[model samples]
Target: MKYSKIFQYAYIVFAVLFIYDAISKYMSNGDIYYPSILLAALAIFIFFFRKRFSKKFDNRDNSK
Candidate 1:
């Protein structure tokens, strides 16, 4: 549970970094960086997946 929470927060941090990278690339090159966009998407997916996983774990604990 603790690890899950840590990873969830880590995903958020990665998302922020990816977004910053994308913006910086855009500002410097005037072109979209596809890899950064993809990484941002993956980070978002992981963030939501962690949320759902945590909820499931909570529900299981409550049922005990």
Candidate 2:
């Protein structure tokens, strides 16, 4: 599989795990802080992956 597809699948798994964690936390403790923090972290992970891939592709295109 391509690296991009691998990244995409990883993102999906991370998202699913994050959602499940958030829901479990909410149900167990009724606190929003931890879940919010986890969500923010997941967002950062996605953003980083996006930027990294974009840069990689951009550089490749520019060099050609």
Candidate 3:
């Protein structure tokens, strides 16, 4: 459970890294990397989804 929480926040870290990579690449060649942008978007979505899921899980656990 602890590890799951840790990994949830790790998604934010990975999103930051992906955004940085996109910015650096754009600065270097003035080209957009769709994959990096997509991954960043996906990471953000996953982070929020995980957060909501965890909250529901906790609520369920508490009700038991």
Candidate 4:
């Protein structure tokens, strides 16, 4: 569980890195970097999704 929590925050860190890379590329040549943007979005979505899933798992365990 401790490692899982760490990985969850790692997703956000990766998302920020992806977003920064996308912005830097755009600034350099004025073209949209779709893949980086997509990856960042996916990372953010996964972070929230995993958090919700973990909460549900914890609740189920507590109920049992």
Candidate 5:
């Protein structure tokens, strides 16, 4: 099951952004909040859905 490189990169970017946001939020409040959890969930969800999401887009964009 091959996946698109764009999807892979999107996951990486989402992870990094989430991590940064989580850390910033935690540092500002000295505790984890909903945003951090949400970001983490977003990262995980993106990873889990990468293949499916990419396939959908790929099929939709078929040039033929």
Candidate 6:
């Protein structure tokens, strides 16, 4: 559970970083960086996925 929370927050951090990277690349090069976009997408997916699990864990804890 602790590790899950860590990974959930990590995903959010990675998502932010990837999005920043994408924007910076676009600003500097006037072109969309596909790799950064893909990474951002994956990071968002993981963030949401872990969020769901975290919510479930919280619910379980509260019910105990």
lDDT of 6 by residue, 1-64 (tens): 7888887789878888999999999999999998988998999998898798789889999999
Off by over 4 Å in 3: none
Off by over 4 Å in 5: 1-3, 52-64
Better of 2 and 5 by TM-score: 2
The total number of steric clashes, by the backbone 3 Å criterion, in model 1 comes to 0
**Candidate 5 per-residue C-alpha lDDT over 1-64 given as tens digits, one digit per residue, 9 for 90 to 100:** 3436666667767777877887897898887767756876777777768767776878888955
RMSD of candidate 2 to true structure, Å: 3.6
Q: TM-score: which is higher, 3 or 4? A: 3
Better of 4 and 6 by TM-score: 4
Candidate 3, poorest ten consecutive residues by summed lDDT: 32-41
Alpha-carbon shift of residue 25 in model 3 (angstroms): 0.4
Model 2 Cα lDDT, one tens digit per residue, 1-64: 2676567567656766777777777789997657655775776688678867777987998999
Structural similarity to truth (TM-score) of each candidate: 0.90, 0.52, 0.97, 0.95, 0.50, 0.77
Q: Write the per-residue lDDT of candidate 3 for residues 1-64, one digit (tens) a residue.
A: 9998999999999999999999999999999988899999999999999999999999999999
Q: Which candidate wins on TM-score? A: 3
Give each prediction's root-mean-square deviation over alpha carbons: 0.9, 3.6, 0.5, 0.6, 5.3, 1.9
User: lDDT tens string, model 1, 17-42?
Assistant: 99999999999999999898899899
